[model samples]
Target: MQTQKIDFAAVQQAFLAAGFDLVGVTDCSPLTGARLARWLARGYAADMEWIGRSFRSRVDPRRLLPGCRSIVVAAAAYEPGRPPTDSSPGKYAVIASYALGPDYHRILRRRCREAVTQLQRTSGQPQKFRIAVDSGPVLEQEIAVRVGLGVIGRNSLLLTPSFGSYVLLAEVLMDTWVKTPEQKPPSRHICLDCRKCVQACPTHALTEEGLVDSRRCISYLTIEHRGPIPEPLRPLLGTHVFGCDICQEVCPANRVRSAPRAPFLPGSPAESRYPSFQELLRMSPEEFKEKFRGTPVARTGYQRFMRNVCVAAGNSGDRSLKPLLESLLSRRGDDPLIREHAEWALEILG
Candidate 1:
């Protein structure tokens, strides 16, 4: 049986029409899992043990899809028009730009599927494909770099010529072998000696070039960590109630941003970017669901979200939040995680 020829040009157009800003293709060569294995051995993944669990599949594309031959990497730029204001005492909390809108996982996955369907129609053959939108074990950034889409910066993010490091990546692994154009190797000087991202991290999570200690990363603490935040790190969290963006905000590569062709999701309200700490403190579980149902913030769940709000409130040094902290302490049914952080915040305010 002859394999149908894949039109690479048509493939690019299909993905671009599906809302991706950048597209590239590469062969499915197995990646050395050494770096990832070493990082995990050093416990850099913190409590997110799933990364280590999916080790084999993550390093080999064939493990994910039997007979995988080529990979289609796509990127969507989400850089905001303006940088978010620095969080301060008694002010609106800072949220990572990526999480401000509707969830990218669903948006990118649907778009990837659409692109695959279009490819099937254009080629007149059924193509076996799997879509991975940050949810799969596939090494997306590595694959993106291999396809000439971008280089990994010192901050460990894909820095594209047009979008810098402020883009979301997705992959379409297919059985159809697509020939990719030969590409010049990306320069190693993308980051140079600039350590702005490292210096800007309040928690010093960027311990070395392109390496992060997840235990100290604010993003990990706020979203992934499921227990009491270490007391010392609590103060460093400042007014951030969700994921942190300090590293990306300070990177020089992100300064000259390109306007995204269109937002991946509908424009989120201003409230999502600059949420009031007071309102978050008083947010009921039902309110939390209604407000963040389809957004990344919803993944934190009510208890953890409120726990983050408490830490931010405490850091704000805003005595006006005293009553709310007291109320949390008064409730017998309040989650201990929330109460512990609330108590710490009350102490900070006092």
Candidate 2:
């Protein structure tokens, strides 16, 4: 089996034209998972057991695509605009910037497939390839670092010089070895003396060593956790209904003057980004599905979303929400998850 020489220049142009803000190639060397093993061993991954289950495939690309020799990593920048402000504190819910648009998985996967097709045309031969857009077991940030895309920040996010930590990552794995440009190794000391993200986290989820305890992470609790949120963390969650971004919001590295508008994920309207708490509390299952159908928030499902809304309403400190919370408790058929949070909110309001 002869390996084909892929034109690196052609590949870059294809990805750039496909709307990727950054693109680089690196050899498919096996990555060391000692750090990941230790992180999991200490139970930092929380309830995401799949991370441990797919440990081997994450550290080695060949495990995902046998005979893989090279990887093309690409990044798309999204605007990390300021969190919406309202005169009324508890009137609206806060959402992470990433989930305010169309799902990245579908967008990146389509763009990656397009680039692969362009590369096949340029090379004049069909190449075996696999596309990963955050769903696959591949460790995207590690590959991005090797490709000179960015350094992992103290918040445990990839912070690129151009877009800071607001870029989405995707990768294309190929069987044929490609010529990659010579580049300096990524620096590990980018965040020296920086503890803004660690200190700013309301839940103290980050460590000085750049590892995150997902169990204490607000984002994980709001979006991933299925059961009732712990009593102590409820007030700390504030009004964040879907995900939290306090860590990224306070990172010095993320203070870019401007970010490239994500071509795939168009800017959502203000109503969508900071939805009214009253509307969300009264939203039916069908309304929830219709409102968040294509966005990442839909992944939480109606039940958990209601649970988050109840928590947010409880923490709002607004007495106006007391009536809605009472209504939720009145429904005997309502999920206990929702009822529990609603009852907690009512007590707080009293």
Candidate 3:
């Protein structure tokens, strides 16, 4: 036990030397409290039934792995620093900044594994270590905040002062014990009745007291929803093709001082803060692959992405592109989801 405490502290210092901007460790006991239930009661998670599974494990990292003692929280920002390109109607669509580089799952998972290797070497105690990034049976944001990495914002995202919630979080859970850092809980909740995120949300996702309704959320509709996007939320989608950033864009936190938390964040400037729609519709498969080869958008496949493009194009209401929208619409005999949105776009355009 004593050896574990000493090794844990040393491993933490190593994490810093290894280039991690944020790290924290805490006991992995399951939280038996109202917060967990409240989070679920609000139904902010949407169709992500997986989030509802392994009920006991999601709240407690220790429950995630047998004999787990401590959890090491880690987060790396992925802001890519480029603004969205302006709208070009149906010919183009704007992808989120985080998707401009290598997939975060790969990036964060590798870094987490490396941290564990360093821990195992220096601590001289070999044990089970699992890495989780939006995976694992643990609640990342809740546990991250509990461990003093950051405070939860009204948007229900973990908001670090420097990274402004544009970060990917992961955890290294192992049976090896560590000297958990002593941190004063956050002094204040950063969001102060800041309705910017709530008001700016293209869809009414944010609700009372940090609750988010993922059903109406653009991120959910675009990526998680396999069927047709409800007509009510389509017009609210704005020009975002892959993910929506309107809420984050309007946050006062994003406007504050922020340096890139990860080394590879700088990139060629985006065409505009909002990419033109025309440029998106005209993006060839080759060009799309070249530009976003290792990006998160690759998971959705080209067909779904182009389908989103058509929907965004029709939303632009530029009657001049009616012919173009018609041409794209003609190609969609197999995908009812794409066809349905395209048809709705035509109505909005006319």
Candidate 4:
């Protein structure tokens, strides 16, 4: 029987139809698993032990789905906007642009599944496939580079000429192989000359080798790192309560002219831009859930989030919020971390 050929154009259309902004295909191959294992062994992954635990599966796509042959990599661009940084020392907070919307995991999974369904039916290929966004043990950036999508930037983010690093990457592993377009070798170190991202890191979290030390990354500190932020790093966090975007903002490559609206962040930009310190300090767990429901902010929960708020309050130099911070410090049953940070904020205000 003559084998029917896969039309790559049709596949591209399928992905675009499903709303993916960027798409590419590559052979399923072993990524830098050994290097990742070494990094994990060195404890660079910080408290994210899950990355080490899933090391084997993340390195080899075949382990994820037996007989996996080709990887269909996709990128969904998130709109880039400068987070409001208040130099006025007022009560303001900054949040990562990605988290200012619905969780990318849910959005990308739904969108990728829709695209995969279209690919199967339209291309007349085997339906055996697996979808993964950030949740899965997949080296999405590596796959993306293999497929000629982009190169790893100095900030350790996949950088595309068109989208820069403001994209959420996802992948679909399939059992069937498809002929992908030829491309030049990926420029892994795209920012060799430019060190803006490195210089912009307030905490020097980025290394000279272009890797992130999550221990000092404000994004990691504010979001992933639980408990009272180390006193030394508290002032460095500035007014960022959730995540930091200073590195991206300083990257010349990220100065893209414009971008289409990110589908996940549906509300008015102001609505999710920055949470006021007063509001966050007083927000109950249920209130936090209701206000940030389906958004990444909810993942931090009230206590940890308030912990971040206290740090931002301390950095804000906004004496007006002292009463609110004082209330939190006196409130019984408050997490000690929150109380500790509140006390620090009081000291800063004084």
Which candidate achieves the best lDDT against the true structure? 2
Ranking by lDDT: 2, 1, 4, 3
Write down the TM-score of every candidate.
0.95, 0.95, 0.89, 0.92
Ranking by TM-score: 2, 1, 4, 3
- lDDT of each structure? 0.83, 0.84, 0.71, 0.79
Residue-level error in angstroms, candidate 3, position 39 = 3.5
Over 162-279, each residue of candidate 2 has an lDDT whose tens digit, in order, gives 7888889999989877777796688665689989999998888998888989888989998999998999989888888999778887888777635564465556456666788888
- Counted clashes in each candidate structure: 0, 0, 27, 0
Residue-level lDDT for 322 in candidate 1: 91
Model 2 misplaced regions, further than 4 Å:
85-88
lDDT of predicted model 3 = 0.71
What does candidate 2 score on TM? 0.95
Ranking 2 against 4 by TM-score, winner: 2
lDDT of 4 by residue, 1-350 (tens): 54444556766777777778888887787887654665566667889999888888998899999988778888888775444445345546777888887888888888878877877777767458898988799988777877777887778888887788888888888887777778557766668789898988989998766578888889888889986688998899998888888888788778863464345566426436676877877877788899889988888888888888888888888889988888877772357888888888889989
Give the Cα error of residue 216 in candidate 3, in Å: 0.6
True-vs-predicted CA distance for residue 342, candidate 2, Å: 0.8
Candidate 2: pairs in clash: none
Q: Which segments of model 4 are wrong by more than 4 Å?
A: 1-5, 34-38, 82-90, 187-189
Better model by lDDT: candidate 2 vs candidate 3: 2
lDDT of 4 at 218: 94
> What TM-score quantifies how close candidate 1 is to the native fold?
0.95
